[model samples]
Target: MKESVSHIQGVGPRAVEQLEVMGISTVEQLLEHFPFRYEDYAIRPIMEVQHDERVTVRGKVHSEPTLRYYGKNKARLTVRVLVDGLLVQAIFFNQGYLKNQIHLGDVITINGKFDRNRLMISGGTMKTSNQEVTGGLEPVYSVKGSIKITTLRKYIRQAFEQFGDQIGEILPHQLLSAYRLLNRRETLEQLHFPTDTVQLKQAKRRMIYEELLFFQLKMQMFRKLERQGEKGQQKRFNKEDLLVFMDKLPFELTGAQKQALKEILSDLTADHRMNRLLQGDVGSGKTIVAGIALYVNAKAGFQGALMVPTEILAEQHKASLKELLEPFGLRVELLSGSAKAKERREILGALKEGSVDVLIGTHALIQDGVDFHHLGLVITDEQHRFGVEQRRILRNKGLRPDVLFMTATPIPRTLAISVFGDMDVSIINEMPKGRKPVDTRWAKHDMLPRVIEFLKRELGKGHQAYVICPLIEESDKLDVQNAIDVHHQLTQVFPEFTVGLMHGRLSSDEKDCVMNEFAKNNVHILVSTTVVEVGVNVPNATVMVIYDAERFGLAQLHQLRGRVGRGQAQSYCILLADPKSDVGKERMQIMTDTNDGFELSERDLELRGPGEFFGSRQSGLPNFKVADIVEDFRVLEVARQDAAKLVNSEAFWKSNDYEKLRKKLEEQGVFQDQKLD
Candidate 1:
């Protein structure tokens, strides 16, 4: 690869600037810019090109191209090509430049999908060629508006020709031979300019394997460090302490919950650091499992801290833990950013002196002045909500504290192994007995009145409801309904009932007051945004009415539905969305068809990809340029096994065979702020 893309042939300064917009500044980056889709350039006769099929046809222009205008500033250019006395119409939308490029009786090849009528090929690639077939296939890249596909293809071809042999293999020969993978040079060549579908598939597999293998290597490195190198504070606890706490609970533990608790307890007793992820669906009793871990830590004469994303969640955890464990002589304290100065000082003092056994709070727990005496366990709720640095800071409070991360979001096993590969994972798939599935449905806008009546009936039955909207207020930019407008509308529609409004724009105190009212059932209807997606848990709220539901992802819709169905009463989730697009309809149907969070999560990953699956702000997900965690699970397994084999070998660490691999991992920044010492 050349030092810069500009050094390559045909990539001038302007071309370089445009390429940089697509994240290509170097020749290697240009080579790595794999095609997102492919076009079949195997030429077919003009009459044989089927409708809605992408194909390439070479023929002579039978007549002069004609340009016609539709609306203001909109024009369509039409040209007819003749192949063996058969005339085929080819239309290009807004491509007036085609009049100057082609003329009467000019031979050319067109690559695009035939329109539904099978008479014309619209919005496709056009190149001047006398041959019938351009090649076996063509690479179609994702390009900027100003950069043409032909330009990108030309530059990339030059890059490969100039430095193709210079692209050396990074993987060891033995490993490559074992995997039967092609070298980098061949992979890049086939991916960009493949001769057949089989070659393309083989080259794609090689690249995917390389990406996943390197990612797995880094993750395993972290795992090995945590298990073999990091020292953790091992706490000593009597079995009776857990039994006593279990006996005090008002409910029975499910088998899954018991298994999770057992695994966490086993980790706590181990000499190595306990870095485990506790994954459970909403209302699956994860908090109780965490409560048990905290109790065990306290019983061993150590302090444990639980961090949540919001103050309301922190408060809920603190209250619930205090009620459950205080009878067992455990002192629970709540600290958050919203706590008063006096309260913060008091809590800090008690925490430093070891009087507080379990502390539950938000980011305030990791404040500079906050200290813990013999801090042993750290539990973080909604693991993705916090950054790695934030969690590290909390862990740094103690001398290698045993860490337990908890997430109410049900992650698929494949995703769990990829994202949280460094941590031992424990899943609580079973809900406690008596929790019924929420009845979910999607309705059109015309069904709003019926939906409102349904909510009224639920509210009349002594239950509460949540009315969620996509926006906070009216926006000229977006046509979706807003929470504030919905709140007023609901208030006017149901004058006899009390409706409350809540959104991110509200102050902390206002949010707390509104939520408190809703929880106490003082507000029969709570209208809010996705801000209530996480912390607002009211058992009496049996109905969730999400407006513009098509605008929400499946995972978030599942979370909103989880807000209901927490009590003995039957619950319902009514999704109101305009199912105009196929994607919209598909998402709505998925929400209505299943209540399984794990299934929805997997489907979400499939439909929306990883970035939107958990959301863009989600941390810890690997940024692989080619590998997809959902589609490449099989490759990931192969890579994971290979990484394990390497990490297990004692000689590999000191041998020169893995020095390049080690340096690559170090340069990847996968180990953030890790001390080499």
Candidate 2:
């Protein structure tokens, strides 16, 4: 097996350049690079065009097309086509590039919605790629900036002509037989050019399974590496010390919180390092459990560190941890980029002098100058916010610190295991006692006054409010309703009260200033972008009114609402929804009917799909071809189990059986060369 191939067969340097634009490089990568969707462009007679069903109509241009410009940036090209005496107005919008592709009186088959008056096929989303597109079924690859589907089709067709035979089968014969999977060669050919929808679906499944298996194999291998050779001290939690602290809490811990705490305590007391992930819904008492863990590590004469994604969150952690642990005389210090010259001096001196028992801060804690006396444990908040390299930096701060990561967004258990197998997971699903489910409602633009009246009512009770918006400025299409505009309007309406605004455009310092004003209760309302998603805990804020709520993901809305309801007071979330989208209505409905973030997330996964869930940059999930995280979960599990089996073998690396798998992992940058002196 080769580590990497220079160029895919039959693809020229120019074609290779195009593939690289979409993040494809070598033959292995190209083979693994599956299509985003399979367009079943099977031919249907011109007379068999259904009202809603898509159809391809063969026609010849009756006249020269004319590019017509509509007002305010709306432009389209229109032409009449004659197919079997049925005249269909073929309209194309924002497709000025397509003008060059077509010639006057040219015969063509246009795949679009066939209507009596007009055919509305999106030339932008769909196009006629060469390689015949094989009317039975064909693969459609996604392209990046300037890389068209037509170019991708050409390169793929070239790939098939050249190296189609080089595609190797990685799955074992027994496993393939057990799963009743298609043969490797047949699956590839069918995926590139399928006979029917049934075969296309099967080919897709085979390919998705392979991609998932490769990912699972890599994760399982890393998990093995983490658990096998690492050793952790076994120190039981001091029950008397813990009970003394718990009894002093202003509010009692919930049953779920207690259970989660017990699991963390057990993990910490074990001989192996506590590599665990703590997940709970937003507003659940995940922080308190973390504080308890830090206290335990502190009592055992070892230091603890809690790292956060932002400085505001760090400040919140510092204040809360101080209040909870100050009675025990635990020396807690806050370190961040904004620390005063004298304050940072004191923190660094105390840290190096072995006086600081616990430390909380942002990425600044991972820097070289911040030394610990005896670092025993490390806790991370909003675990996914930090990247892999940043996590490694913090881990290298101490001598293999017991790492624990916490996430406020609840993920499905299968997803949890699949994504984070290196870490033991403990979930706190149930809410704490006496916590009220936020009263959620979906409103429209017409109900603005009603929502404002509700906000004013909350304010009359001396409660703060948060008005959320997705964008910072107004566009011609979307009414701005920006936080800036809202803030001005709000301040003018309620002149007696203070109003503060924040958005992504503001610097961290500016945001922090606005957030501080809101936290201090100086601002009656905080009009802002989604920047308030995971900041300080403001218990006084009881109302979250999100304008254009449909633009936000379900998990994000939950996070925004989490900004409120931190206190014992009842909270309300008013969502302004657009009537144009039914999917948006369903998304907002999931939030209004229930308070389960996990439930909302699964529904979100089903609705918006995985690409929107994981975000585009984080894992490039939306870019995957056939691997539907939701639909292909069975394949994910099977691949995970197979990966576990392979990693267990002492000679798995030596086996010729895994040569293709090994080469694939290497190609994925998972296998670094082991150089020996």
Among these predicted structures, which one has the highest lDDT?
1
In order, candidate lDDTs are 0.84, 0.77
Encode model 2's per-residue lDDT on 1-677: one tens digit a residue: 12233444556667667667777776656665666666556656666676656676666777777887778687787767777777666777876666666666776667665554344443422343442546665567767877777666666666666777776787767668877899787787787667898887788778888778777777666666655566776665568987788788888888888888888888778777777889999878899899988999988888888999888889999999998888899999999899899999989999987899899998888888999888889898887788767777787677767889898887887877665655678888888778888889999889998887887788999999999987787766876477778888999888878988889989988988888888999998999998888757888999999998988888888888888887889999999987468888888888888888888778877887644566642442324567866667767777878888887876568877677777767766655421100
lDDT, residue 501, candidate 2? 87
TM-score, prediction 1: 0.89
Clashing residue pairs for model 2: none
- Cand. 2 TM to true fold: 0.89
Per-residue lDDT over 1-677 for candidate 1, one digit per residue giving the tens place of the 0 to 100 score:
64899899778899988998888898888988988878887777666666788878788998899999897788888899886576778888887777888978788888777774657787886877544455678788888758999899999899988988788777877788887888888999999999798988889889889898887777788778767776677888888867777887899999999999889989899888888988898899998889888888999999999999888888889888988889888899999887789988999999999999999988888889989998999999997788778888998999888989888787788767666666789998887898899999889999999998888788788999998999999997889999988988999999989999999998887998899999888999999999999955798999999999999888889989999998889999999999688988999999988888888877887788644555554566657666776678778877888888888897558788777777677677645635211
Each candidate structure's TM-score, on Cα atoms with residue i matched to residue i, is: 0.89, 0.89
